[model samples]
Target: MRHTPPRAVEVHKALLAHFGPVDWRPSLPPVDELVSTILSQSTTDGNRDRAFERLKARFGSWEVVRDGEVAAIEEAIRVAGLARQKAPRIKAALQFITDRRGALTLDFLRRMPVEEARAWLMQMKGVGIKTASIILLFSLGMPAFPVDTHVHRTARRLGLIPPNTNAEKAHYLLEAALPPETYLDAHLNLIRLGREICRARKPDCPRCPLRAMCVYAREQGSGGARE
Candidate 1:
């Protein structure tokens, strides 16, 4: 059976009881978060961090990065991997923002409805639903649920969402099912669960807090259930 909103809420509560509260708030401006999220694509967090720091240290400002040579941008973020692709995309996103809004700031999104803001961000070449939701929720403090790989996988295993739902559709569906206030905590906890317990390969389902409710755990039989 497809999981209902109440079941999703139950999963959220169980996760909270296990992992406690997490602060997923973004400490950077929207533009910075946008670039950081872009840099994070197909890379480890450590590499993304290094690349972001390097890019900032080299350019000192988004305006400079926006106008800087593509080669320099690629070199600065080389550690992130896919610099050839990410560099031009990042520059193009910034340029698009600058041209459309007459500035590089994403603060204006705070005034737009959440969906409107997401749509605006998605219009950028490299920004997809996940990236846009990250920018909206983390940067703008808006109610957007970003369905990253971890969240997507965890949700499917828990039957909170369909197993075949695409990340883009999962983003909207999850946001609709979950309470607005639960988005950040749920997002963080699900990611932690995916990383530490409900891993992609050979999940440590025996120790998972959601094992009782997870379809994947049940399918794994008693081996996944702790004594």
Candidate 2:
């Protein structure tokens, strides 16, 4: 990542070719995104969405969520797994935003520098780099790249970062590899690859479009399906 990673450009192009254009638009308000992302931890997408929907239905507003009974909140998001832990974190995040910004909105982050915005959100309980970056890139259209489990795995396998790199460090390494403009598409595409072809338990290396340039694929002797 000393310079624009020469491999990253090819990886981006190949992923786009295989996955088609990644047309991502913000799907939630920043606050909703923050809460949903917090709920997404250690859970599947279906579970995360279900939990968010239930939480929203149970508490009609962020203010209500902040002040509502934690037991009630925990019950609503129980399907998400670790409901006990997530419920309090969710309440604390809303409370922090209310306390610091004097309201429930995270819209103010949209106007600040990306780093400043990231820093501000990370101040909230349970809001780490991944959660903050998701709120930034997905909701606020900022340039911060979030390194989730899928992304982290795919990045290392592709030799984009050091093999032993941790998720936090991999975030910056990937940011340094691809341009800001490619973050959304690249991030989504990498996650797709990880889920479909480069899966955690038994990656389908032979069927992967990235097999030609992927370090793991080459090592496994699986040529690119497309290449």
Give the number of the best model, judged by TM-score. Answer: 1
Backbone clash pairs for candidate 2 read none
Residue lDDT tens for model 1, 1-227: 44447988999999999999995547989999999999999999999999999999999999999999999999999999999999999999999999999998899999999999999999999899999999898888999999999999999989988888888889888987888989999999999998999877878887988888889888877264332
Query: For model 2, what is the alpha-carbon lDDT of residue 91?
Result: 95
Off by over 4 Å in 2: 1-3, 223-227
TM-scores for all predictions: 0.95, 0.95
Each model's lDDT = 0.91, 0.91
Clashing residue pairs, backbone N/CA/C < 3 A, model 1 = none
